[model samples]
Target: MAHVKDLWWKTVKGPDGEPTQVKTARFGKGKRWLAVWHDQYGSEKSKAFKTKDPASKHANAMETDVARGEYIDPKAGDKLFGDFAKSWFNTVTVDPASEIRYESVYRLHVGPRFDKRKVKAIRPSEIQACLKELEEAFSASLAATALLVIRGVLELAEADEAIKKNPVKSKIVRQPKWQGRDVKVWSDAQISDIIGAHPAPLLPLPVIAAGCGMRQAEIFGLALEDLDFRESVIRVNRQIKKLGENYVFALPKNDKTRTVPMPANVAIVLRQHIEESPPRDYTLPWEKTDGESHTVRLLFRWPTDDQHVRARNYSETVWKPAITAAGIIPPPAADSRGRKRYETTRREGMHQLRHWYASVQLDAMVSVVALASYLGHDPKVTLSIYGHMLPSADERSRSAIDNRFEGSGLVPDGT
Candidate 1:
């Protein structure tokens, strides 16, 4: 049986034996009613409520849960959010990069607010508030990622029965609208200017990216054996990725190898690049293991060294300066003490070249399915991202409407 106890006040007696009402320690500014119950394991547990009605209600529910054998000890949820999140992180399996991203998201945004909170006590309102705060503090993508990290931890807690349900579940929290860059594709003129501004070793990078739509890492990891001049195709099987201190050869983002066709110009550029300087053996660890290593004949080599190009080093040194030189982006302004600090480049990454390729495919009237296959993207993704660039369906609709009226007298043709 469950019960609620009244937190009574003591009565003070006057000298004339008249009783004067006085508040006790239990009656002042605290929960007045105590809900007491025994768990299925015969352990006494108590919770305080501000009023008798709520206390009685909770006590009865506890008894009902115990009788139905659905009772969970509330103590199981006493673990703090930070403590539980750490354990939850260990249990989940993700790529090394994703694991690092999750940790960064947690440390930067999620940890400071809710790390001290109990898992079960976190409410949907609290989660919504946190998301709103994140929106104010970070970019839309960062805020959304932080919410996902929290939801993942709570989901693990729910699976473990630490909480009845995930508080971050449902439509309570919403991702803020992207307030960053417009989804832009560079024009052919702009592409030429940027590529022309690039120096040796970095010159072929833009041509391959715009021509084949290969990702940066995939291009960096491109091997001599993977390219076929007769077939005019590039076999994209692996990409170079940094796993901690060592670099590894990992499968492409979709985990699928594909053969991308190249134009005659792209083939010519590759031929010239290879004739000028041949591919060298760049060794990296195997993707699935740390102990074993292998070497590949990489097409692009760092100017100072014979090693394969690192994306970070190349982006900061080669790509950004080239784009700025091409007048595609303004040069970084000098700061105090005559130091120049660069803000993040605006749509100047290798992905912009990929977008240009997509625009080219769309402009050529390639079907969405075929375009998706060529780009190594899902059909829906290709449509969602680049579908707007397809030749205007509105113009076709207008032509059809004009043709319908051309032969009909129901209304004056063009009217």
Candidate 2:
């Protein structure tokens, strides 16, 4: 049939107008079928079917589809990129923030700039130039995010026959890597000096935060019962995070509960402190009953939960003074020179204590897996980031160990 092709119904003028011609041939799977002349202009194509009934049906529809010029070519369906992306966004459901970012990129960055353009119209040089503009006009992270979204949308457009190829895939956009920070790890001397400077309200907190590496909220949320003196473990089951105005103790982040081994000194200090000032179920110092506040009630008295509205609030009021007394650094030189002196304080935030814990664990040569379980971190993350911090003698063997054999004229590889 392919060799004997171009056979169609020819319309000759006058008489009965035209004669309907049909051809027979074996198609795929070796089945014989009748072919009809569908397109006489424009596409000038034809179709085939196993029966005359379906062939006739297709002839009528093809005539209509051709008349309206709606018969799109499957091969060329993916000719445009941006126009296809909008449809892709509507069809896809993703994480709320990611979805918002994808839509924003399409509307504000990609669609308006390239919607009218074809798939092949987006050039590599042009994409790089656009990316550079994005970095300058916004932030590197935002630019990278926009680039990734554009690449995904374009690929989908190609799949949906909206574009011929994914142009944005080849575009260059560097991702930001986590750089090591020059964070102030609590040294032995600094820890000693800081611990000595504060004696009362702020005194016990440093021991919990710096010594055991408890977060300020975790330290503040400690109830007399949460401490296990016999086991020498502090149960960090609850955390005080500000959901809005007032800080409330919530189930720990990632729904985790971890017990931190405590030193005998820390335990003694806590026991003495608890005996002196007891809290109810380790509740905050700001617990309220019918709008009434009490002391010796919450270890850390914060504003009533109903009074505040913010997420992740720390006990800074008590922390600042403790930090000043500890001499880690003074609370930003109190601004007294009007608007010019209103500089923000450089006090280390809450996570410093967490970082301090990880540093100590690494310095002690604790296994990464152990630290991961202890800190409630994903094992893979702990291994990749902290595994190298304090390398064990036998846990990991570097090339330097084999260098001794090499220097002594040994070649395991038979060199």
Candidate 3:
């Protein structure tokens, strides 16, 4: 229950023999009303008000909220966002790769901005301003990632009832669209030139990439047993990712295992490469922090050393040089200020092959669901990325309508 009382200017003795009315400015203005109540824990709490009506209203609401178990302490939200984020991070369970990404975003982008601010004190405008700053300072994709981390932290705070609402949600703070560089595909001649320039052991890499649409990590993690020749499918189950000096085997992105149909040329190239060079055992940790190990007979290995090829080392020594030799990238330019010279390359990554594979499937009019399954992505995601590659619906519609009148004798001769 809550009650209200007035403080008069004249001193009055209480049961404890102390002055009940203390001299204050409120006494001079005749506005010394106080709402009195006990919290859920039976702790006495009071808020001074200027008049009887507002104080009584506030006291009643607080009492009702406390009784109904919906009361949130005003001081609970005073905790610093940086401290709360550390707690939230521990509560989330994620893979090693994702954990690394989260920590990096927090350290580089999120923590420094809101470390000193209380969680509840963060307003919607502040969040929007931070997002705008991030967009200006970094790529849109990176800005989106940083905002995602901040939103996650605020969501946890909201769930804990530390704040009445999360400012990072919905229209309050929107993540900028990732306006990345345009997608580039290689021509048949360009593909041939690149493959010819690469070494013999790595000859099948380009074929598998363009043919099966395997990501670089998945390509490096491919094993001989994962290929089913009879079914003509490549079973993509796992990928190798680098964490510091250790290589760990983890499930593919989204933890999805899929089988992609193998083209005839791709299968033929894989068979020839396997016959010429046998697979060797590549051992790695099953988990980054654990000592447990797993070994697989990797399809591709480094030429000089019998080990699974690392993506970075392979890209620099094999793929980059191949791009240069194939005339895809120009030779390194000489530096004028006595600095080391560097090469200028096209904006083509190994992912371009994946894009080419998507193009091939879409041009053939494959079902969106089937294509997404083949690429180990959601149907909506596949459409967002490759929907433009689908054949024009207007042309098909016109052809369908035109064919209806053909051979029906309803078509007139040229007038």
Candidate 4:
């Protein structure tokens, strides 16, 4: 049950023994009307209003909401968004790398805007405005990640009954849209030049990337035992990834361990590489930097250090130099301090090898499902990315008709 009380006046027995209303001692001090109700938990809750009608309506609405099992404590969302978001983030379980990335995005992008605000005070328009600002200030991918973090926080708030609704999910808020560019695959000549330009000891790095479609990290973590020459399949079991400042051996991206077919040429190159350079044993923490220790006979290592390859160091010192020597990119220019600085984009990275492999597979008429399995991608995702590289429907139809008509005396006749 809910009721409204007049805080400015009270009813009492008069001198005539009849009930009469009179101003209370606290009259003219604070709101005149109070809406008081018991919540679903049977706990008293109240709101003050300057008018009697609004207070009565609020009390009635509270009673109706409680009866309908849709009640939310108005004060519950008074918790700061930063506090609730941090607590919610701690409860989230993801891969160590992803967890670190989420934390960074929260701290850098999400926290600055909403940390000090109360959860209930955030509105859909405010979220939309924030997203627009993020879109302007960061890359589309980062903006999307920021939106994801915000949504996760608010969704948990809603689930915990701390907020009446998740503003991030409101119809007024729109997620950042990312229009992915078509993958531009490198030509066979370019691949050959790049591979040929690599120093003899690192020749197999680009070969494996172009042939097996292994990611750079996966290549860094390649182990001798994971290669099966007899079966001609590379077991992609683990990858070396950075957890903060320390490197750790972790499962491949998406926690999926898959087997990719090894091309004959790739296997031959690998054998030659092993004969010349030989695999080196290295130990690293498993999953987390401080987790259990694990060792593997890695195929690639920094030449001087004879240790696991650091991605940044390898990229700057090895991969970029090879590409530059191959004429894929211009030579490094000297900065004001006479330090060599190369103008390189992600387009010139080893990931281009993956695009080249996917293009080769698609051009060879491999099925999308099979290519997806070989590349450790979802079938739909593979199709979305490499579908443009596949033979067009019109070309396929023409080929089917031409093959059916061949040797059947169905040549085109001049009209």
Candidate 5:
């Protein structure tokens, strides 16, 4: 292909104190070059060279980029990922706690890699590499989360005509070895250890989580308004996460807002917790002090929209330590940040409660569709992940050995 030299002429004053003659190219496809600059005084400017050598360098670079078929300006993408993310957050900012989790994924994983890359040029290989890199740098769970943001961004890109197709296809989306982590769940017997034990305040949530199969945030996000003592069912509709010094409430994950059957175990404690627990504006029992506490009767995401926060602070400040104190998990100080260590405890995150609840429900052989409804899971998701978690999986698998003749018993006995 033919090429032209670049002739970049920066404006300058002549020795005679007049604006110097405009520099012209001696040997190139053209003898003229143009200056592009901001007109505002002392604003900003840049020059494009129009000479054979320097200009050829530009052409050569651009040519090489075209040959590789993978070059986009660092600043001229559909939008810088970070900038787009912030705007998106503003438009859809959940509660403070949810913001923290999203920000964590943005800062720690997604933002740095794709921030400046144009959305259109984002390749499947690049996303795969990103998922792989996160897996290497962090945990499988963290890798899954990073991909979550990437997937959302690509979907936005497709919507905006930045790309023809979303790069994050189902098969290309990576799935790390999760759903089988060796987490220690509190068994039915172990549940007794923590009831009104030392620290005293930790008892109620664990009971609720393990017994009713509610998630950690659900346990904390429960407000007085959602509880129905007469119905023996606690409505779990919203939750929260902690961000720096404040709370941000948001909707439940998996779009899950459910009503769990309250057994006498969880119900009795909840009743006692309600009376002694002060009327909180949001539900979770956030620490009022190291010793005393207050109950949040309601939680607000933006005080207007619908969303919930992480329920993380309550987990750290209340749930985990309490579980440890109950002797269900190891004592605090398990995971630390170097010499400046935070307290260690077992059952570190609220997911533990979720796991225990799943295990309990599985042990009880709760029909998966019903389980999905209770846990607010999409139809197939609960069966896919926890179907194996059921102790009856072996029995089900055994039944599968020769059940091609499966028939409806409700049909005539002759049939």
Candidate 6:
């Protein structure tokens, strides 16, 4: 039960056996009213007020909150956001690469603004302001990542009862929207030229990417056993992820291991590539750089040293030169010291091959659900990213109606 007490006065028994009010010894020394309540754990909690009415209302509200199972300890939120976030991070479980990214965003963006502030002190308006500042200071993708880290920390605070609610999740706070540009797929001629420019030993790299829609990292981790020629499907099991200076084998994105159909052209190319240069046994740590070692017969490796393919090295040396030779991007310019500087953006990266593959699948009228499975993405995610590439719905509708009415008596032949 909760109630308010008048600190200045006390009820006592009078000579006539009736209750009477009397001044206490320490009357007028402090706040006149005290609101008293017990928390869910039955621990006594209290607050002082200058007057009786406000103290009574406070006590009533606390009682109501406790009855409704919404009790929040007033002093629990005094812990700083940074301290809570650090403690919360220890209980989080994510892939190593994602863990690294979350830590970076927390250190570089989230911590600077909210670290010293108490968890309960963060308001939705302040979170909105922080998001606006982040959008102005960084790319939309990076700002979105920062928002994720902030929300994660605050959600834990709410769960721990350190805060009544998460400000970041409040309705007033708006997340930064990513203004993603339409995916520009390379033309068939451009694909042909790029594939033709690769060295004979590595010619199958772009072929597999363009045909199977595998990410660059997934391609790096491709192994001989993953290819099923009889079934004509490629089992996407793992990817090569770089953790600091070392690399490890981790499951594919979102930990989804899917099978993508292998085209006849892709299978032929793989067979020929295998005949020319067989796969070699390669070993790398699993998940973490210092984790248990795993070995597989990888199809792709550096021809010179027979080592695993590092993305940066392969991009600078192999991918860039091939694209330049194919006229997709201009040749590199030489600096004063004669070092070559290639002018290219993410648009020209091997990911373009994936865009090309998606466009091809959409043009062929493949269902978005099937394509999402093949690409190892959620159906909603695939729809968002590749929806624009789908053939015009209006045209399909027109064609369907025309075909249905043409043979029916509903309309007289083109009338």
TM-score of every prediction relative to native = 0.82, 0.50, 0.86, 0.92, 0.60, 0.87
How many pairs of residues collide in model 3?
A: 0
The order by descending lDDT is 6, 4, 1, 3, 5, 2
User: Residue-wise lDDT of candidate 2 within 268-359, one digit each (tens)?
Assistant: 88877767655543333232222233222345433445222122332344444445555665555544564222122333554566667777
C-alpha lDDT (0 to 100) for residue 237 of candidate 6: 96
Highest-scoring model, lDDT: 6
Per-residue lDDT over 193-305 for candidate 1, one digit per residue giving the tens place of the 0 to 100 score: 87898887779999999999889999999999999999988999889888766688888886788888978999999999999988877778777447368788888888887
* Local accuracy of candidate 5 as per-residue lDDT tens digits, 1-415: 3255235344568888888646555434444442333212323233355444665555455445445654333223457556656656556545444456767887877988988877766788888888888777776677877776777766665565445577788476666544544555665555555444424344566677667777766665767777787888888876654547645444577555788888887777767765654444533323211222334554222212333333544455555555566665565453355432245443355566667777777777777788887788865767666666767656788787537435645434563
Off by over 4 Å in 3: 3-11, 14-36, 46-57, 132-137, 175-181, 334-347, 409-415
lDDT of 3 by residue, 1-415 (tens): 7988776454778789987866654555746788888888998788778888999998888799899988766667898899889987998787787788878978988898998899989988888888788887866666777787888888888888888778886586776763313455667677778778778899888889888988888988899989999999999988888876678887788888899998899999999989998887777887574747878888998887777888877877788777777777776566887653337433556777788788888888889899999888898878777777788999989999789977777887456
Model with the higher lDDT, candidate 3 or 5:
3
Candidate 4 lDDT, tens digit per residue, 84-170? 898888898887888888889899988998999999999999988888888878766678888888888888889989888898878
Q: What is residue 221's positional error in candidate 5, in angstroms?
A: 3.4
Candidate 5 lDDT score relative to the true structure: 0.60
In candidate 4, stretches whose alpha carbon ends up further than 4 angstroms from where it belongs are 132-136, 171-178, 405-415
Report residue 218 deviation for candidate 3 (angstroms).
0.1
> For candidate 4, what is the lDDT?
0.88
TM-score of model number 1: 0.82
Write down the worst ten-residue block by lDDT for model 1. 174-183
What overall lDDT, based on C-alpha atoms, would model 2 receive against the true structure?
0.58
Poorly placed runs, candidate 2 (over 4 Å): 1-177, 281-298, 302-316, 325-327, 334-347, 383-388, 391-415
Worst 10-residue lDDT window for candidate 2 reads 1-10
